[model samples]
Target: DAGITQSPRYKITETGRQVTLMCHQTWSHSYMFWYRQDLGHGLRLIYYSAAADITDKGEVPDGYVVSRSKTENFPLTLESATRSQTSVYFCASGAGSLTDTQYFGPGTRLTVL
Candidate 1:
């Protein structure tokens, strides 16, 4: 598991419930990111953490939360998920440097009904 992996590759749930998608990377990269992709819209960053306890909100952080207390795991939680939140989630990681390239995990497709 030297690369990143996402759990529950597919999910379907009703609105107003909370759902958490797990992300794990064995590379021990210092930077982790969460993003959501929707039809007609490219990936939008939800949150990112440079290191343990160093997290920041990205462009679309509303309704979503992330934590990175460990270097190899970053989980994204949708608090009170809504129909509007249905989208494909992706997890990515990179070294803690600007010159590093990010590696993406297989996406998780979530549908809210």
Candidate 2:
């Protein structure tokens, strides 16, 4: 992926409610992923997909859900927002392998209250 961007750069939501973060890429990368940036955890992968409809869970995917209905769109949803889930979320895409370069989208700042 060469270009990526996220929508609703900042969001505030109440606990137990659902929130979805949108990510779009201009390039058609084979792999896309969602990661959360927290104070202590640094960057933790929430979920990833190799292709459309082929998804997999990552390090911290418990409270999150992801779907890639198209090559350029990957949306991450928080099933039930919680304070612990408050963090900056980033979406990234890569060519195919781990060694390939990846491009990250502008992060979404989510605050759960």
Candidate 3:
């Protein structure tokens, strides 16, 4: 695929369990990001990686972990899923340029019970 893609477009899980969302891109972009979209919060960045093995936390990083082991894959893991984490998760990638626009995947809607 030339663009990005996400897995488990819809997910349901019990609270306190771990869930991992997958993100893959073919463009080999240098920057990858994970964000969660909620009704009031809009888009909040959870984590991002500039390149392989270089990851950083974003605005809402608590209870979430991200790893970029390869240039084209960035996975986000929720260590202990909670009801508050229920939202739409989106994975995006972009070039290093500030002018570059991020390309978003379809998104994953997760619900925690």
Count the clashes in each prediction.
Answer: 0, 0, 0
Q: Estimate, for each residue in 30-105, the C-alpha lDDT of model 3 and write its tens digit.
A: 9999999999888999998889999988999999988888999999999999999999999999987523799999
TM-score of each: 0.95, 0.94, 0.96
Candidate 1, pairs of clashing residues:
none
Worst 10 residues of 1 by lDDT: 94-103
The pairs that clash in candidate 2 are none
Candidate models: Cα lDDT each: 0.91, 0.91, 0.93
Give the least accurate 10-residue stretch of model 2, judged by summed lDDT: 94-103
Off by over 4 Å in 2: none
Residue 14 CA displacement from its true place in model 2, Å: 0.4
Comparing 1 and 3 by TM-score, which wins?
Answer: 3
**For candidate 1, lDDT tens digit of each residue in 62-112?**
999888878898999999999999999999999867347889999999999
